[model samples]
Target: MKKYTDEFKLECVELITIQGYPVRQAAEAMEVGYSTLQKWVRQYREEQVGITPKASAITNEQKRIQELEKQVKQLESDNNLLKKASAFFAIEMNKGGKSR
Candidate 1:
């Protein structure tokens, strides 16, 4: 597999995204695989809306945003678990009191 620089990836993505070139056309002109260029364009669009890629990000700002978004998702999951546990414990305490 060939390794392309981040700058190269961005330019390829821009050809399809910003410059309105077809993915197939851009890929052919750039000598990149069609699927690969398509993936780059998809990642670029997703990053614009804060959807992080599983692979390396296209931009530095997007990388940071992806990190933060992951952190936020983890925190939210933890909070939800804590809320459920608290509710369960409260219900248990009430059951014990009522049984006494």
Candidate 2:
């Protein structure tokens, strides 16, 4: 419900940068969680350090293969259950037709 303003976020970032407050102290002073403060600090550091752009995310073919494999596994399980049920009913019917 309560959302922080851009100015508040920037001030927290700046306080940590200029005043050199450890994440805990900065978070307490700013009335935010330590983990939240740590997250901001990490993002700041990552931005400063710079990162290479990435490609080669999951391909469509790979996603399709995964989906197909899951479907096959589910169908195989269903087929196995059907086979077991058929065999069980056949045994019961044969017993009824015979004796005992």
Candidate 3:
């Protein structure tokens, strides 16, 4: 995944504002996909009601969500492993052998 920096975002905004470049050209010049730049422009417009010189902002909520998702995935894997281990041990106990 590409990590968009503050400077990169500022440059993109500049391309739109100071340079008077079209959205598609600005996006291409900044080495970002058109949709991504467009989304930023749209968000900046919608959120701030088209305030010129877009803000270089990062939403911490995305990082928080990613961390939470990772933890959930780990917990799920651990639960699955425990279930499998329990089933394996149960099979051993039923076989009349020394249980591990």
Candidate models: Cα lDDT each = 0.90, 0.68, 0.69
Q: On residues 22-48, what C-alpha lDDT tens digit does candidate 3 reach at each position? A: 999898778998989887766544534
RMSD of each: 5.3, 11.9, 7.9
* Model 1 Cα lDDT, one tens digit per residue, 1-100: 9999888999999887789999999999999999999888888888888777888899777888877888999999999999999999999999999998
Worst 10 residues of 1 by lDDT: 59-68
lDDT at 86 for candidate 2? Answer: 100
Model 2 earns a TM-score of 0.45
TM-score of each: 0.63, 0.45, 0.48
Candidate 2 per-residue lDDT, tens place, 49-84, comes to: 542113211223433555676799999999999999
- After TM-score superposition, what is the CA distance of residue 50 in candidate 2 from its true location, in Å? 3.3
| Predicted model with the maximum TM-score | 1
* lDDT assessment of candidate 3: 0.69
lDDT score at residue 76, model 1, on the 0-100 scale: 100
Task: Identify the runs in model 3 with alpha carbons over 4 angstroms from their true place.
Answer: 1-34, 41-58, 97-100
Tell me the deviation in Å of residue 94 in model 3.
2.3
